[model samples]
Target chain A: MKATHIQLAHGNGGRLMRELLETLVFPALGCREAFTDASPLASDKRIPLMASDSFTVQPLEFPGGNIGSLAVHGTLNDLAVSGAEPAALTLNLIIEEGFALDTLRRLLESAGAAARAAGVPIIGGDTKVVPRGQGSGLVIASTGLGWRDAGCALDIRSVQPGDAVLVSGPLGDHGASVLMAREAFGLSSGLQSDASCVLELAHAVRDLPGLRFMRDPTRGGLASVLHEILQASGCGCELNEAVIPLRPEVSGVCQLLGFNPLQLACEGRIVAIVAVESANEVLARWQALPEGQSATRIGHLTVDRRVILRTPLGGQRYLDELAEDPLPRIC
Target chain B: MKATHIQLAHGNGGRLMRELLETLVFPALGCREAFTDASPLASDKRIPLMASDSFTVQPLEFPGGNIGSLAVHGTLNDLAVSGAEPAALTLNLIIEEGFALDTLRRLLESAGAAARAAGVPIIGGDTKVVPRGQGSGLVIASTGLGWRDAGCALDIRSVQPGDAVLVSGPLGDHGASVLMAREAFGLSSGLQSDASCVLELAHAVRDLPGLRFMRDPTRGGLASVLHEILQASGCGCELNEAVIPLRPEVSGVCQLLGFNPLQLACEGRIVAIVAVESANEVLARWQALPEGQSATRIGHLTVDRRVILRTPLGGQRYLDELAEDPLPRIC
Candidate 1:
């Protein structure tokens, strides 16, 4: 069904967002490859990739990272998960008039530090300002460009029913942290966001022939990413709720707020589908890295065309794609 | 001096904008080439170029184009003026929640038409939405990627004192049209924006040995572009008041508002510095295109370090970089 007016859910990285893009935005552009995280620039040798994203989170600064750092990590992670080494990025900022210059400086510094950490250069950018009260302080949109390695081709079509699903670390910390940071929740802990790029993880598993696909669950969190893979690969997933990694604080927050942790955002996590034979090796390599110490096998692709979750109590429940936004502007 | 807060002028594409970039952004990235319209991507055989621009025009729709077309033209024009052949573009839209779906459809259609006209593809993009009252209806950020031909290396450093200044068409129409559309100045006529991509003009002059530099006068308009060229080339400019083209309606609006037409924005215009020997040929070639029928020679670079305007009354006036925003969110 066509929407007469946009809803907040349209940006929630869920069903409404996908429907909106497929209906109003994607068909107009006539570029089908854009459905993926990044598009491959046509080349004779290496496959060049590019992706763009706009960050709009209330209270620009959040635990573990801010909008600027998120911008860099988000764009670079998109390229990294697409099997590309981020070479350069463009930062486009829309600051509200009367926004503190010091805040801008701090944000840019954070972005620069993140870029340095990731070994990528911010090669070009544009800055614009809206009148005060028209924006939520600042919005940063970053575009990343990179190139994939030779003989490292990965796609959803390569996945099979037996492929193993692995997550690099805990999920939903970013979403939960941002949620707590905004609106007074009064339930605060030492939990922080997981907002970092996983280039190291990509590097560790890039040469593996069994790696079928990789994605960073940001918006609709882990559930959305799994659903997307199912849609693309025409397969299903069977996840073990007992094995899924979730921080205690994050879980507490989700339980209190009545939010499913699987539907929350994770800025610095990687969801990889690998051949069952090489899953152990990939998990071992990931566990060796500091960013992936919590790497574990959470599930495997199934022949049934539905995502099933097996709870710790040995009960099975279907995890459908979310239709409503649990949190707005969480990323 | 450092600004404690971001001023509207800082995003005006004028003096303050340059200061903000040089002081905080450029140094952080450590990529000096980003100071240009597009940065050269590291490649073995050819220099691939990328440019990004964010459109935050008020009213969403204007006389000549909407935010969508402006986003496409603004980005591609940056690449075109940088001596790159238009290749692919990425669209990032941040729409206000509750924005009309039909309006978005219209805007996307406009953008698709513009991309088709330029023979470029919209390859990849991202979409985000802000709550109502937090955005000016819609904002579009577009990133363009292209490549420079082997021999067509153009830069401000190559410009000399004897180079001629040429503009593709009348200036200030876009700024005036948008301004008139925003407020009821009680003075209206058949004025429309000159929003277009100068790819054909760029193509006509790409092979010319004397083409030193090219830029589109968007924010801060024609005068700001001249100031930028002067800053880079360490040269001055002398413009003939009688020869600078301005539409009658635009001139009238400027008169009513006590503004200089040169300080207004032009979405689809080109200010090129070419050697005096090839200036006439370039102008003639531009005149052949429907979009450049008003191509004319307005001035020439001079050894003096100031932009001097020679009036029709035999008096000279200095043109300074705009310090205040005559129109905000003019795109």
Candidate 2:
């Protein structure tokens, strides 16, 4: 992590990435909210959340979704998790010269559909072209804006020792699918990305007084988010490994690759921390929704600042911050 | 323009770029404000503007600004031209693996300075790295949010015949400086980019009843803006080419390179349309500002849908849509 040059791990949304943001980006830019999922805009009444991310998946097209839909879903989820009502998005595209028109058309169509489904519009955008070989075929960057009533934001400060953590659905499906699609390991499990907007899940629990914090396990996956909450709140968690939801196909791919599924990405899932008394209610509401059908309580926050996983074998292990990005550009 | 593949022209912010947005992106995305500089966020009271743009300039650094400052200026100008007071920004970085850390730091510093000067903060960002050679060292895509009192937004539909067109300052400085710095044609110039934020100018005349529209002449330069106002308003223009301000060095390079300075980019300039009665007030107010000291009345909107250039030789000629991209990735 001491490397001077940018390593793939620096963009992995893991430890190195956190180091880069805290050391270089945040300090240099003086951005207080540089590490948060979304930052609240300056407002008197309802403060809107604004956040952005750049998507650069290797193959562009994958089993469950393409880069377009992934871009839309990624930005929307960031806003949703920050307790905002998704409103609008801006699409910025850096296309390689001589790229196929039909491919661009297809991607935009998917992006349009995702926006429409989420009830957001592509408001304004920019397009730039780099010479061939100087750019990936396509790179999409999106910024999402969402508004919510004041005091409804999910801040790490809100998490207390007794808060319970829950997962909306399966983990690692997105990372696994895109990795399998790349055939990097000479194997294909025919998995699909679980990329979708979870505004519905956010809405179900948005008004709940017990909701403390929420986040989407994206690039660095569930482990990264857990570490973020622990570090930010100065608290610990005892995660029940057996209760963590995992799709069999996704777990199979990770096991074969000797990768931890908990450290893999999931595009369409929510990691929620709520009062222990209301955990079951939140789970029930999420489970009633199609995207969150498998919602379950995975763990609970503690007084210390270490993440411990309670294995089904009656043993315990510390879940450290993800070191290297096993799957680069997995969106 | 009819080609099935995206050529460098499509990203030039000229005719081809317009065609792509109109025929493909806009239609597919169903965005009514797809062509505007910024879109108003949905709200019952004050409406804020949201916009995004990607910056991928060659050499990364130039005389007046680097890609980082350019990223900030470009997005802020877009929001300003749309008549909003810039509030926050999201920075998304796509870096090439192994890119120099010092270089990244310097760029971030510049970006930070620009954001601070413009009174906007870099709230959140996502960084991803592509393997070396797949990217141009670094690419920064930024999204900006600006708020305006309800009903203060500028729309192209407000343009009308007899409206005077004004240039904030010299044209083609940015495009010329970057083009010369590339040394692609074995030529170099001491000229610097006019890259800057014109929020002050935007605020000065934003409340003027005569103000119709404003735009930063970036990618396709002065000619492009003229054409855009004409096309969007379904009107014509009589541009006095002899009166348009031009820096001697920029014009020299453009002439030597067999390019039209009129089509060259100007990152810090504004092309505005205002009522003839108030054009003098707008010009005088702008000229009093440092960035707009060279401001001058350049032309007027007409009743027809054709743009005519009043040549210095006293002959009139058609000013067509930017037919080619003289310098790609200039901004």
Best by TM-score: 1
Cα RMSD, each candidate: 12.5, 12.5
Best by lDDT: 1
Q: How large is the i-RMS for each model, in angstroms?
A: 14.2, 14.3
Task: Please write out the lDDT profile of model 1 over residues B1-331, one tens digit for every residue.
Answer: 2554333333322234345445533332232322321122334445567788888888688898889889989988989888887677787777676666556667777887788888887766666767767776778889988877657758877899979999999999998999999987786778999998878888888888989889888777788778767766789999999999999999998898888888888999899999999999999999999988999999999999999899999999998766546567888
lDDT of 2 by residue, A197-247 (tens): 888998899888899988888866787788777756888999999989998
Per-model C-alpha lDDT, please? 0.77, 0.77
> Which candidate number maximizes DockQ?
2
- Name the fnat for model 2: 0.35
- What DockQ results do all the predictions give, each relative to the true complex? 0.14, 0.17
Model 2 Cα lDDT, one tens digit per residue, B193-290: 89889889888888988888888887667776777666567878998989989989977887777877887888888899998999999999998999
For model 1, residues A156-274, the per-residue Cα lDDT tens digits are 67899989999999999998889999969777788899998888998999889999999888777788778777766798999999999999998998888898888788999999999
